[model samples]
Target chain A: MSAVRERNSSAWLLPPRPGVDHGLRKDMRRFEDQDEVDIAIVGCGAGGSTMLQRLARAGWTAVGFDAGPFWDPERDWVSDEAGSHHLYWTEPRVIDGTDPVPLGSNNSGRGVGGSMVHFAGYTPRFHPSDFHTFTADGVGADWPIGYSDLRSFYEDIEEELPVAGEAWPWGDPHKYTYRPHPVSGNGEIFLRGAFASGITAKVGPVAIANGRFGNRPHCIYRGFCLQGCKVNAKASPLITHIPDALAHGAEVRADSMVTRIGFDERTGKATGVHYVRAGVERFQRARIVAVAGYSIETPRLLLNSANARFPEGMCNDFDQVGRYLMVQGAPQTAGRFAAEVRMYKAPPPEVSTEQFYETDPSKPYKRGFSIQTVSPLPITWAEHVMAQGHWGAELRRYMSDYPHWACLGALCEFLPLAENRVSLSEEKDRHGLPVAKFSYSQCENDQQLLKAAQSVMERILTAAGAEETMTVKRYAHLVGGARMAADEHHGVVDSSCRSFAIPNLYITDGSVLPTQGSANPALTIMALAARTAAILVKGD
Target chain B: MSLPLSPRDGGERYPGFSSVDESDHWDRATQGAVLVRLGLPPDIRFFTAREEAVARALFDQLLDQHSDPRVPVVNMVDSRLAEAETDGWRYADLPEDGQAWRETLAALDQDATERHGQGFPEVTLDQQASLLRAVQDLGYAKWHGMTAARVWSLWTRYACTAFYSHPWAWDEIGFPGPAYPRGYKNLGLDRLEPFEVRDARPAQDPAANAGGDG
Candidate 1:
């Protein structure tokens, strides 16, 4: 007992280190501007963080640059929704088109963990058909790599995140690591509705911890998942990968915004990156540069990095850098019930069903949507109430009845349209770079799918004994600006997420997805980063 | 009026639920942050005196807060604008949120002078709401060189954000505020945490009695 007692503390089951000791080390190794590392990753979010960890473990020196702060969640995050707006990338961007997607905390984040810090912790994997939508349903573009390629990475990341849920019967039919957390009142209403509607539902696969794995604690059921988890119960790269990456000798430089990828004119390969830290411009040299700035910033960086060698952009030789931008049609329906469904008491994501993920012959749409319980806080609920044309006394009245309402969101797979894209606007940011001007409009298919999804949501709510229901049209999870394809003629990157135009440059974020499925994009984005890091380690 | 769990005039739905009491059980950081909403609001720094008057009237109409013990929404909104805590993206057609707020407030006064022969704050609540409704009815049409619908979105978005972040508003909504260290264990349908109070008017359809300019 005395000899093996220390080893039996279950500490060996944890990933490299207990995640709580994320102290911003003052004496950590810092590379000079002229020192060339093995890899320089832009945006230390899901993709960059994952790649940095893998590459560091393989004995490759790596550095990551993020425009946001390296957050100590306990200090930086609060339980209040309005106080948590600092975590989002709230830089001024221009939005246009028939349906302008509202860009703020919902879809964009700025900190070391990126959007996952504020994301609702729903980490469902994309369906197998999502890899080949063109082959299966004859609609959207097929991914260069199939679901089988990212399956192992997904499994590994799931164990790393320690995802909690019941055994999933949808998509590829997998089991999560931890048993499902208890369902909240909002989730119960959703399950009740799905059962009544003859649709099967399951309790989560959210990346939030159920009990405990490492130094991270269990979820507090505080209902502030979108406002950055201060309890260390949720999974963000800041905890899941960055700590391990740091332990393995990866340097993450926070509040340093990478403005452009520096390219060698003669070699046609990436030299490094030009970034700005506290208003001072600097350069970090690297053998390889990976841009993981998600969709908008990734394409924005490529387009802004035009040189004498590639005047159009780094990977825009065939004019496909900022094309095929996509967003899931995330419309929410809130139902008022007789019972108190205090949705803002637990984690926002608790239950989901992918029954309508594939196309049905009876439905007019080619692809379908997934339904999840989305719990909006007070301010968000006010917006939902006002979206239904209620103001004045009506607004106050509806908002006062907030405790009895629960919401359901439908993530309809909007097709990747070339015209719906992110281009550089004339307006400049504080860094003097042209801001991203995102133009979006629903196509005929998108409009139809949304209509179908909204109808189904209303039906489900009505079936669940809702006295009244109101639908709000919104969008979530921006992806696919610098997409991957089989050829350079139609896409920016290749199957390995390497730029076809530049040999050592890679794009390993949601921007490289050829088509985004109805599933949340965080898991797929991380999986892609793992795949890219594996390919790089293989010397391919 | 300052008593615990007192009814808020005639519209109090959760009669005896005090959101401030729930604050005591929160973590120290959260409790400190939330309790500040009850203290003195920030001064109006972004808007002028006239702009402030017009904006306050607009918020009063928007949230239906006609009398005393207001949530200081105008000041909250002013602090946001003065601190540049905008909601990130601005519509390509519109200016930044601060500039748009100024323009819209001035436009409201201009519209009031045109329609009612008085300023927006000087006009009756009925006249002010009708003028606002006219802009809302425009939908996507132009009003004073800016899109009417977007201006409405900006005004309501800021107003709602400010109003709903207060404990007074939370009390009216029966939201047990800031559950951090002390989390709920009872999670089933209609299950209440020990600190949470059940909704008294759960069956009442708020929409049925909803009355405004429309």
Candidate 2:
């Protein structure tokens, strides 16, 4: 039998479901223009989608507003990288500071699922030390809450995402719900390299389905994880939470860009959000409003809603709304081997290790980073090659050697520097709203962690018998613009993610993260939203 | 003789692999997009005729497309600019990417004239490469009112994005093109999917051959 026929045999096939059901919007509830909803969520990505699901399940009338289209993955997403450009937020912003973070495809997303639609399926949980970074290492701020507080939510999200992996042994040790998926060639190389370097590694806890998961199909190892999974196997809130939210009477309004959060000065609370849809400005009133537009836009919205009562910006009484922005020092190193590694097979995220997650007295840096296998597609591989200053025939040569290369990425826990911030610039978007001016610069600790991380990657690759290695300097996952802290003076929101100054306003996204751990923030962000929804429900 | 736009013509590096043939198994949309990239590329909608001429020459030199059947990188970039599908952020020092592209191409011509008494497109390949190298070697210094390093960044990013997205580029690199409904079963180290091709020149480190530290 052919390989395709053998793979499609009865043993590999799941008990067939009809197909992926994306018609959840069919019976979705539509609120009247005058009706005040119980909750209004902004940006239907990881956090907002989770919030919408949880709030509606708790019998609250909620609606989510997304700036981009309501993506029917089948209709919208393509397997090609450049063709999938519509999935990213492509509105121009001014990037500055010593080391300005590149925006767009790497760090931002558009449409109903937000960046999660294009995110690699890695979903590692944050360590306990992440919450008390200041207490643990005397650097960065502490989260208002702890890991124990969100532990149950993380477990719940894991079951919902139905993560597949070996029993995790590092930090807050745990086991996954599904058995680990088969490791790919690139992943096998990472494992071998880690072993040869005397470091530990495991298969995955990626959100990509390993077995039958609801109506979602199993992963085919198609290698287009970054270009929006055409296979429903990869977990995005689009499939994981939004359909559930719709079932529970939540409405997701796509192509509706929320411009500003309307304030009620007399009540000292939020009224609703003003948004633009199809070039028409409209308002949606809600008793309580939540901003989950991730790091950049969440703070941009708050700062843009500056009224006479709070000229510095709403919830920016202490000027902490858009401060302490953080991105992981994600430098990827690719090693060329004698055999064809063909890093483009399977999912981009296959194996990872958090063995170097915490601080060591021997190391100069206070925090550490995680090493993981990263497989870049042809276009992304070309970018990786170009980042090393290769051009002309030299660039073509490296790219042609694509099949011989395997890659590893480091998620270095860079300390949040106050100077690495997002503020409104004089320039405006097509909507006439001021665009975000993001300034990012690495601190001493951040620089040290990156150097160490790159060195370790090189060491592992060299030990694994690589003929040559190329390092590409990059960053990933934006977090912390409107942070959650112990008091109003230190953060924009409280432990419950409620705005410290405005009673009815809340922020539930990666923006609420005080100190990010080395883990990918998707799972943590979803857990935080889940926690926030439960708190609101319990309080009511 | 191969046609000027033949997808099969550019797979010289990986003589055995053809991403165009591999596209037969891809889903409709993906297959359509990849095949379209191999066909007659889009017209010059964003750049002026003069700018397009300069850009075509620049992309050829930057990508080392020295012969016929070259990937239409200039056209791909022009389409991106026409649609305003920008990368979202611009350096504070430089103008928007579209405007910066126009200004820089003009500057390249001016630099060519100053050094070799010719337009950029008319200059010798060696002279063009040297001029571009001069701009790159300026690092952060100002050239034509924009940071030289940023100009290099702008040009290379667009050029690489356009070039590598083409089906011919995938063939040249031995990439098996888009795998969708048909996913891989053989996933162990050094195991190629039945349809996937192995590297023919794995022993030769291109960086070592070219003395590129990268």
Candidate 3:
């Protein structure tokens, strides 16, 4: 038989009901019948899945709904050519642009696993100053909860995700002891060069490679992670928290899109969420509704759920639900070395540097940025470097020889400005829902940070004996649109991720981040979700 | 009787010819042989009118070069030729339905497949079917298909290389090279220059295209 035929035949090796639980079926039926749960989670991505697991473990029943499909690593992993399918979040062109560029990272996974399926799994805690940007830097608002309050939650999230790295040695409260997997050749080179330059660098924790801690297998370092992993290595919500939630009778409904948040006007609280299921609009009522539909869709849902009591939109009484938008603009610099560094085939770069995490008032910017080394495949690297347009012979030659190229990038923090907002576009989808239009820009401080980060990256590359180096100036990682704070007047959600205007509605996604942090936001988002779950379960 | 020129005599007659240059001759000879084996006319003009029109059609058809090789140049040849022909002429000389054109394409496809083990049109069609299957099975078609047309329009306008290399063209028409963008610096069209339309043809030798040193 041909290879294709043999693979097709072997696809049925597993039972039809694989990864399904009897308790989950029962809970799903309960949700279908409109049974009330403690919370109705609107999304099942990274944040929603973590929240469900925490809430369920704390003895609260929850039902999670996601329009995206689940990911099965074994079934999903194919050849490199077919790996692009792993990046599918929503239906292609669902969020239409003239260029058809995907709205976000093929970062979003729809199905059971959500986007955790394709996540790079770098987990870094936000700096202490990140929680109090308004007070410290005189920009953005302060989080109701400080780094001290979230420290324990961050530790819990890291444990749940089972990261491998030594704790921060600088005596920061958020630091914890971790044994990260050994660094690769490129990672080691980056570490040596960064440290030689007096930069604080270490093998930061990644949410992969635990030896069966949470019923998930250890990472096999396949390096095909951006596609789904067949070995259950990556700590995605699908394999980690979602399964735990299901074991505790929590349910998840895939392909179910929540259209609007149902509200009881008299009490000024959300009653339930009305969603579309298989072309039918059905109402699923609950005492509490937690919108974890990510930063963009979370605000879009609030804007779409407008009622007479809150004319602007649900929870938009202050017109601040989608304001204060920020994306972590990661301008990177890459250098080619004369070594046979197979960076692409290895697990993601497990180490990073935080020498620039603090604010540098002497420079043009008040807030600073963090630098990290990452491993990328030839295709991904080519996409980044060639974005400057060095093609044909020069492109082919560069790609063929630069397999050992090392990259140093900065996760620069963007100030949460009120002008950066998400609004409904006049254009509507097939379902007649208004498309989301995002208007965002970087401040002068952000540009300065980028420039300084570039200088730092160039210096490090030069120290590392790099033959050639290039820098990317413009890039973004969407975050901080619906920030969390102490007062409802300044922010949308309160300290515990509860919307002050709507008591029963909680948002635990990137939207609740008070300010953009100079680190990967996934770990922080997971930590916040865990924190919120603890509060809601304790009835605080 | 024309006397056969010795290798030394040939080198003396054509200074560019030498024993060391056999590889270049071999490359040109191989290309000529392949065209002949496929029963295509030596001149690219035999396939279409106007060099630009031929280049565009070749660009569209080249997409299927890797997948199916049974598609005939005749399929893309006539439409381009007809457009060029109409642009150059005021009155209609032949029927626009292009019955002769269709026949020419059918004959070319059949002849090429029989002679050279593959033809452009058949291979192009088969490759397209395969791509559609891949895209549909991966759910890309369902997600991106509705908007792919619009995306293609924008991609063509902004990134012409992307349009030229788009994989979908292999099935729909036989286009090639929609590989991921690499080594492409944004020049912003400021380097536009005029080129003389020369009667000289491009060198068929593979070495001439190698290294791009030429």
Q: Assess each prediction's global lDDT (C-alpha) against the native.
A: 0.85, 0.85, 0.57
State, as a TM-score between 0 and 1, how close model 3 is to the true structure. 0.70
| Model 3, span A1-540: residue lDDT tens | 233222111112222332333444455434553777778998887789888878876767788898865554434443132224434543311232211213434334556656666777777788778878778878767888888887887776666666767667532734444467666656766776786777768876677754544334555543556655555556667766776676666778777888999998898888888988889988887888999887678888899889898888888878888888677767778775655344443466467777787787777677778777666544455455444433323333343343346777788887888877777766565467875666666778877888888988888877776766777554545566677877878888888888988889999888888787787778788888888888887773
lDDT of 2 by residue, A35-134 (tens): 9999999999999999998888789999999999888776677788888888999888889999888899998998888899999989999998888889
CAPRI rating of model 2: medium
Question: For candidate 3 chain A, which ten residues in a row score worst on lDDT?
Answer: A4-13
Candidate 1, superposed: residue stretches over 4 Å from native: A1-19, A22-24, B1-10, B212-214
Model 3, residue A137: C-alpha shift (Å): 2.0
lDDT of 1 by residue, A291-407 (tens): 999989999999899888778877888889888999999999999888888898789899998998888889777888999999999999999989888888777778778888989
Candidate 2 C-alpha lDDT tens digits along B133-211: 8888898899988889889889988998898887777777878777876878888777876666666556666756665
Model 3 lDDT on a 0 to 1 scale: 0.57
Share of reference contacts found in each model: 0.68, 0.72, 0.01
Q: Give the number of the best model, judged by lDDT.
A: 1
Higher-ranked by TM-score: 2 or 3: 2
Residue range B48-129, candidate 1, lDDT tens digits: 9999999999999898888887889899999999989988899999998889888889999999998889999999989988
lDDT (10s digit) by residue, model 3, range B2-108: 11222221111222222122223222322332223234422444333433332333234322232233333333343334533211111011222233233323443
Cα-based RMSD of the predictions, in order? Answer: 3.1, 4.5, 15.5
Docking category for candidate 3? incorrect
Every model's DockQ, to 2 decimals?
0.66, 0.59, 0.03
Runs in model 2 lying further than 4 Å from the true structure = A1-22, B1-13, B211-214
